[model samples]
Target: MRLVNTFAAAALATGLASAAFAQDPTKVGFIYVGPVGDFGWTYEHDQGRLAVIEEFGDAVETTFVESVPEGADAERVLRQMAQSGHDLIFTTSFGYMNQTMNVAKQFPDVKFEHATGYQRADNVSTYSARFYEGRHVIGLIAGGMTESNIVGYIGSFPIPEVIRGINSAYLAAKSVNPDVQFKVVWSNTWFDPALEADAAKTLIEQGADVLMQHTDSTAPMTIAEEEGIIAFGQASDQSSFGPNAQMTAIMDDWAPYYVSRVQAVMDGTWESTDTWGGIDSGMVAFADFSDKIPADLAEQAKAAADAIAAGELHPFTGPINKQDGSPWLAEGETADDGTLLGMNFYVEGIEGVIPN
Candidate 1:
């Protein structure tokens, strides 16, 4: 009987240790520049956070602060999360770059991942999707479908990332239809619905038949639907908001990246790495083409997407010119990552001042 009691006590101790281990969950935090319900960038990022939750059921705990401003307030929120013992934090906005860097300096132990930022630190990693690839595909569709030969693009900021997308879209459109004209309007805000809607209306009023946006709001799509024009969804699929108006969406799939990063942290292999994934890496995806697009043009768009994913074609191939008509690339040459990463000016044929 004494021997049996000893075995029971030993088993109880082992169980207790296992229970303690199970109680310690990895705490992860996410900071959003816009509300999760914006149905654009933040919503898609929240979907990735949800993917993390689903990937590691009880092994991880997650929290988020949404609609946080991208200034000092971002730093404060990040500091709070770090102080709260968040093991990993993802800041999902370009404007949060300095704030993320500042917070990372304060907490060297916490890991940070900032989206669309060039800055990096020992504890902070930067990541972004090659959204330009998707832009190229949609541009082909726009070029083929536009009756007015005018395409309007709503820009969020004059940053390189947004500029790259505009240039890519315009280049692709011009390739297919040299007569295509681009009109660009800057909204300056990423998530203001009223401002985005006003921009859309203004562009349409200015004789734009096709509308595209780099901003993170469905207001443009909503306006497109009301005005019976074609538009593309940005960051996330906004088809539900504009079934007829939405030509296709450029989806940012953060699930795979987020899950892998979190797994690295759990396995003690997390490091400061810059990841720029695109259509080939499954980071940039295209939603289904709307029926408004002709079948032949849709096929061409899909083929172009396939070519990009397979690396058989590059969007920034030579014979391209800068905004001032200067030779940017020679024939049979391609633009390297260095130049693409800091693309500040428009390619030839795009007329506008990149607001400082």
Candidate 2:
């Protein structure tokens, strides 16, 4: 029964693609998890949306709805977009995974793309970035610069993606300074500035001298600046929020990928494929190092960044152990795709759960 449904879905997607090809001015739509003015995740995605419009000018038309919550409202908005004749839809949030899948089944004639998710169907594709790569670099700086040796991490969820970043950052920090320790606070919501600011204040009260956040807002950075501690930006270049407190930032560049996918649709070659890019691919990038960072530590971070981009170093190499003291990887070995994709445990140096 499952196989039959899969075949039918594939046939439907193919038919839709054929019809879209036979028409001019392909219609594309986007769904954002936050407001376009958030200056974080959604804002970066909207930049990519603009790039798509500029690239395909007369050949493509695009529309988007911002600040859509991730449950029934998301499904309703997606269905409405499809009903409005959007040939392709891009759902820009991990929480939209199952919602996208459900909507795709209902709108078999439309192609769907989800960001930072693993699930895929005949009409759905998943894409993400090696964001932890940037975290590793920032961790090194945090470890080297912290007089308190306490770093605070503001995370949104305990999922594999967020946990993998926490572990990678911890490993990098421990490698530089054995005394460095991490404090984590999970807020569960992605874009709540008030809640995120309160979490940052709590971490500051706990003696954290360097701050990092996985949540999608500038609140954490602003808090770091107000408290005179160092912080790193996420999803977008947020240094403007904390010029003195921001040591560096990870910027998400999605224009290239967006262009390629749209071109695939134009050329009749669109298919379900998972894309994960790192430093070398320009999908994941770091902002310029700030003068607040120690000159020597900045040099070290840049060297590591160069090595990773040149394919000479990997952030997740072993002999590594989990928090339970069980070996996770052997010496001279690096984590494979499957292991990284399913990562749900903290390394020995970390002191928290991977959160269910």
For all predictions, the C-alpha RMSD in Å is 7.8, 6.2
lDDT of 1 by residue, 142-210 (tens): 999899999999999899999999999999999889999999999988889999999999999999989
lDDT of 2 by residue, 37-71 (tens): 88899999989999999999968878788888889
Candidate 2, residue 47: how far the Cα is off, in Å: 0.6
Top-TM-score candidate index: 1
TM-score of decoy 2 = 0.92
Q: What's the TM-score of each model vs. the native?
A: 0.94, 0.92
Worst 10-residue lDDT window for candidate 1 reads: 1-10
Off by over 4 Å in 2: 1-23
Q: Which 10 successive residues of model 2 have the least lDDT summed?
A: 1-10
